[model samples]
Target: MGDQFPPDVIYEIFSRLPIKSLARFRCVCKSWLKYINHPYLQTIHRFKEEPTPIIFQLVPSANSNKNSKLCKISVLRVNQLGTITIEKDHVLDVPYKGWSHQTPVLGSCNGLTLVLYEKTPWHGTLLTLINPVTKQRHDLPPVKLRDTEWDCPSSLQAAGIGFDDSTNTLTTVFVLCKESFWSPAGINPPLCTMVHRLGMSSWREMPQTPALPICDEGVFAHGRLHWLSNSDGFHSANDGRKVVWFDVKMEEFGLTDAPKGGQYGQLVDLNGEVGFAYKDDGIHIELWVLKREEWVLRCRFDLDRPRHIDVVVCGCWNDDGDILLTSNGGKKRLFVYTLKTDDLKEVKLDGRCEAYIRMHRSSLFSIRGQNYK
Candidate 1:
């Protein structure tokens, strides 16, 4: 090879670096900045073999002053040697009304999280795309449908963020349920499925979407957003009320069977595979992984044991193939468990707070589908 490094070699190097570092390098020179917008760069960054870190959001306790708009966002990672460490923990001042609670974390994609802040009484909800690592932020415009959420107040909304591979764009999705809105002719509560593309200034309504509400915001995995249908079933995917997924690239929805005997399950991204954790009994937690579209028994952990008492899964530390968990109802502590070694490590949080998770991907070069960052 010539003195100039092979382009493929350079691509490999960039793919492995955290996106936050890549964002800084984009300012080095014009020649290097050109690659930020290169279409192939996204593919390399996304497909590279790397473990994603888990992000935890800690909010103030109910006893604390609710007027405070500040909260803490922490990044947790497990090194190759199986050591769990806090990569970062910093305070973020969320400048929105009633953001201290009921804050909608609409999933994390490309290291960016889409947040929905709703006014009390649940009106005038708006969105913001934030990269906790880069500290770069974008406030999304207000979303409107025939019946804006304010028009009909309800407790149900399914919102999330995902990457659209076909167009190399990030997407935001929101679905309001069981609310009536004023139409030109009459008041009706339409199946309001809203989508906002990264670069777009407006949110578009998607009709024909199922009217059922999703149980959680949704988890991104297998190139799609997956969530449980608010339908009754007994741990059987064959029940038809199993799992629902939205494919970002194709902008389509698909249904598949859920794990057999699954109950009180939470959808999760176990490494790159889609999986979930559920209480098998009072003492143990059952985890199931989906490989080749087939459900496989991953592993089980004891939650009632003295060491694991009152523990609940928060997310996965995919790097070390470990599960991230929280203990105590107030989410006072975090723990990392190795599936292979059965090792458990506890991470202490100074105070009790609510916990939310986001996966850390290395696509920091692009945010909101813009290359200038």
Candidate 2:
């Protein structure tokens, strides 16, 4: 009986169970619910239990009559025989009508996914923090920028979300570029930066910004938000793209060396560390993982992908440690790369519409202490 065991023992048992089981047990009693919701227990459970790899597939809206876009979220289950199965969990109907095949997961940390609400002629760009399992959504206030004062056209160039362990807070960083055609000669519009805390009411501008323009997506790992830059601003001629990282706690920007390879590279989260995968040639794909602040070669394999399908390495599936790959090129396929066997297996996804698959580390816990309203 739970009543006989000490609270510590009960906490340990509850922390070891799957998130779903923990959620169910929360209904057992008020004490159990409080224990499960405690910050200490939540952190222990998160570190002790591996987060399951979930796939977020963007497909046509389920409501045939509506012109809105839909996102189908599913959990991936892999058995010992390497057979993969999908279990549908949730579906999100994006209210916007101008949705494309582009991925909406701007950043994700601790089961919280950050999505971009594109700016329109009427309003500025907005960010939202969503927990698919909890079905809780936090729409961030409009990003504050000085470009509006100058009446310049500003676009969201890069965005990322990260968790600050020291502060126990979730933070988001944005990079915006403002262009004014009537600017004086020899003066280019400066890139603006904004930083926001999860429960904050508004976004605050960062004092400085990355010297070079950051690529679209950013990967959160090791208490920092990282982005890949194609510009040759910081790196020498020998190095291709530069890896830029922002410390969520320190609120500063730093640069790290990227592995030598092709011009285009993708950043992924391997467990809790950062991983980089790039194509050396048209056929060979090289993956490097960051260990002890150093980039170590994980594996290399020949990838025979569909024509025009741009494959990006989605992090490893914690169940079997197999590498998951998806394409941002709007293809409804998932490539599971087995490291030991050195084989690439394709998992065809359902739905006739094109899809973009993203690996999400999910939990069933609610996102407490956020400004949901």
Candidate 3:
């Protein structure tokens, strides 16, 4: 008999193996290595498997000294099945002294983090893309919007990072504008947005959108960068809540309208799909999914009255997904939701301080279906 089994049966078996095992099995033979590293294998790995859970450190109030010194970084592998563990307390390490409060931990792509730091004096803010796990950091130079215009001390800036697998390069994009010029004045500010590709020493100005309220959170997924827009109240004529997506490959911005019937919810990725959660009548928490240009309500869970749990949606897949929601109002207790069974399980963590969880890479593997087994 030939050394190969049916390709369909091989895929079925491989789809169930964890990424670590698959990584080791890549050296089984030349054919095995070739099959595992194939582009098709990477595609299946990217979309088929469940990612490890990571936490985004949400520091307590600025007045709390005990928590102020803590570095707000993302923690991975807090929850998983057997044979997986997260030994490190924090994923990324910042060497700077003192705390940069609310510095904004943007999304992480390809083992790197897009962090925004506020510095003093002429350079008001610094945008950095660092590989926390690898300790490799790239600091982007200051972006000039106009020939004479410089960064304003009072203005707030937001940034995001995305990696192009095709080119194996990372890109950082920043949007800076006057803090007070958000309104539709007769003369709007010039060059409100700028983008900088890696290895370039300077920033390039880009066309600005029509003054939408910027979001506080940013994430990168599927080769694009996304952020929530609070432009609902920008102009009396415009709707209030919208989500904006910036395509890193194409360098364009597009808006995805919010669900028709929700208020005060956060946007997150659930198994690859864009997910949202909102508290309805303070009694029920509803999770919604956006797929193929339609918003569908997926699951709902009842919350105890006046408990005020902080819910943060992470990522999803088809009918099942994951959510990291804090139950104790102090960020001490965290719970994960499995949409398949609509079950909410409290994540038992070893650390006492508040922790953050994010979704890492996923893949597929087949052991017994092939000749190696």
lDDT for residue 224 in candidate 1, whole number 0-100: 86
Q: TM-score for each prediction?
A: 0.80, 0.85, 0.69
Off by over 4 Å in 1: 1-6, 47-68, 77-88, 99-103, 120-123, 148-155, 178-190, 232-241, 306-310, 350-354, 368-373
Sorting all predicted structures by TM-score, with the top scorer first, yields 2, 1, 3
The per-model lDDT (C-alpha) reads 0.63, 0.70, 0.57
Task: Give the per-residue lDDT digits (tens) of candidate 2, residues 61-161.
Answer: 65574645555555555444456644344445443333464566688888788876455434567667777655567788877554365322246678888
**After superposition, which runs of candidate 2 have C-alpha atoms over 4 Å from their true positions?**
1-4, 47-53, 57-68, 76-91, 97-101, 146-154, 180-189, 232-237, 306-308, 351-353, 371-373
For model 3, how does the per-residue alpha-carbon lDDT over 1-373 read when each residue is reduced to its tens digit?
0166876556556556666566677668776666665556655556554555555564444554453333455445443566223434465644322234453465666545666544433655566665443334566575444433345543444567676667545677776664343446434443356667666667777765524555554566676666776545443323546767777888888887778556577777666556777776666788877776568998898655355555555555223455556553254555666666776666566666454455544333221122210
Cα RMSD for predicted model 2? 3.7
Candidate 3 residue-wise lDDT at 283: 62
Off by over 4 Å in 3: 1-44, 47-49, 56-92, 96-103, 132-136, 142-154, 164-168, 179-191, 221-223, 235-240, 316-320, 327-329, 355-357, 362-373
Q: Write the residue-wise lDDT of candidate 1 on 143-245 in tens digits.
A: 6544344543343457777877677777887776535432333223345677888777678777657434466677777678888766543223445446778
Residue 373's lDDT within candidate 3 is 9
How many residue pairs in model 1 have overlapping backbones?
A: 2
